[model samples]
Target: MDIVFEELDYCETHMGDLMLRKRSIPSLDGKIIYEVKLGEEFLMSSLFHDAEVALSHLGLDSFGTKQVDVVVGGLGLGYTAQAALEFPNLRSLTVIEGLSEVIGWHKRGLVPLGEKLTQDSRCRLLHGDFFELAQSANLDPEHAGRKFHAILLDIDHTPEHFLHLSHGGFYQPEGLEKMARHLHPGGVFALWSDDKPDEGFCKVLESVFASVEAHLVEFDNPILGGTSSNSVYVAYAQ
Candidate 1:
């Protein structure tokens, strides 16, 4: 029999009723899955992190052989951040997370890859609202007036299906333009969406970015016992 172990660290964020839990499923056997929820809505799960990792792989791949400085918004389970560090030439990585408890999990080595991410000298985890920071001229508050080679985000379900209303603004042209300002020339902006690419959103990105592309990443869903897909939106900064 598989045992499900869960604990709620804390709740009552700006978003409301946030909970972090752990589970072991029959399908996963010995593997433990970490999950986060806002109210009744399931936000992220460790079991379904293929697209999160792919966000870094596809975004960094476009940069080719250059040593890159990267920023990852949302550090859930640290999959995306861990993926970003996989590149050998990665110079520095900044993971900006909204929830302080999530950041603590990594520093305390509570999750499987937590120690790997926290121990890396190249990575820094800061607590803040990713949406607000992304719209500012500086992506990282600690190091103001600095730009990055790539910025990968996995915070929301999609631009249209935002986790919070406050994030809705950043998906638009004006807000995205602000994010673009902090990117080095030819820097990459990649977003992980639970839904397929939105044509209208792509149009919005094209207006601010030099080029834009959408990629569908396929992965197996252990719960559904079938293949599932998500979209990766990449916008290149000039």
Candidate 2:
């Protein structure tokens, strides 16, 4: 039997109430959609992930090296990490997620891309805070002071909006420089934002990176009966 609506999992964390749900909309031909919510805000949905996938392509495609080691901040729905693994030349992918419940969804096969990521020898799911890790030099605990070829971030809503107050520092010039230290020279840093391209954030990127570009990715909005767009900021470290 098809579940019209089901809340798969719900738990309380330091962050807030986190819930994972699966539902089918009869109006949309019973298309099953998986949704994750933290507190009152909807974190991610399986229905709209075009920008999430683009975060990987835009970042990895801009890298100068063929063998790329990548770090993905935020494991929401595993879309960004899964997309990064699709790269043929990707050497390794480390995903840093703040919440353990989110990781549990993947390890327990509650999410669609769970097994695909876990079975892949190249991917590693690490439980930690991305913002805190960004401040530190090493993203991987196994390797101290290791630099990556690319860092793809999808944690906060935008450079100005954040899930936590502490995350706000990562967008600043000093914090950005700290995160840049963990990337190889000419490495890529791409971010996914729900808002349209922001010129202010671009200026911040230009201050730290050799080049910067904001890509507007548009996708169909089935529920809204129109189109919606998201912003992707891709920058290369000098």
Which residue ranges in model 1 land beyond 4 Å of their true spot? 27-30
Cα displacement (angstroms), candidate 1, residue 117, comes to: 0.8
Sequence-dependent TM-score of model 2: 0.97
Q: What lDDT, from 0 to 1, does candidate 1 have?
A: 0.88
Q: Model 1: number of clashes?
A: 0
CA RMSD of each candidate after superposition: 1.4, 1.2
Candidate 2, backbone clash total = 0
Clashes by residue pair, model 2: none
Which 10 consecutive positions of candidate 2 have the poorest summed lDDT?
A: 59-68
Q: Please, what are the lDDT tens digits per residue for candidate 1 over residues 1-238?
A: 7587878465687777878788878766767788888888898888888999999998899777799999999998888899999988899999999988789877887778888998899999999988898887677888879999999999989999988888988988999999888889999999999998789999999999999999999999878888999999999998
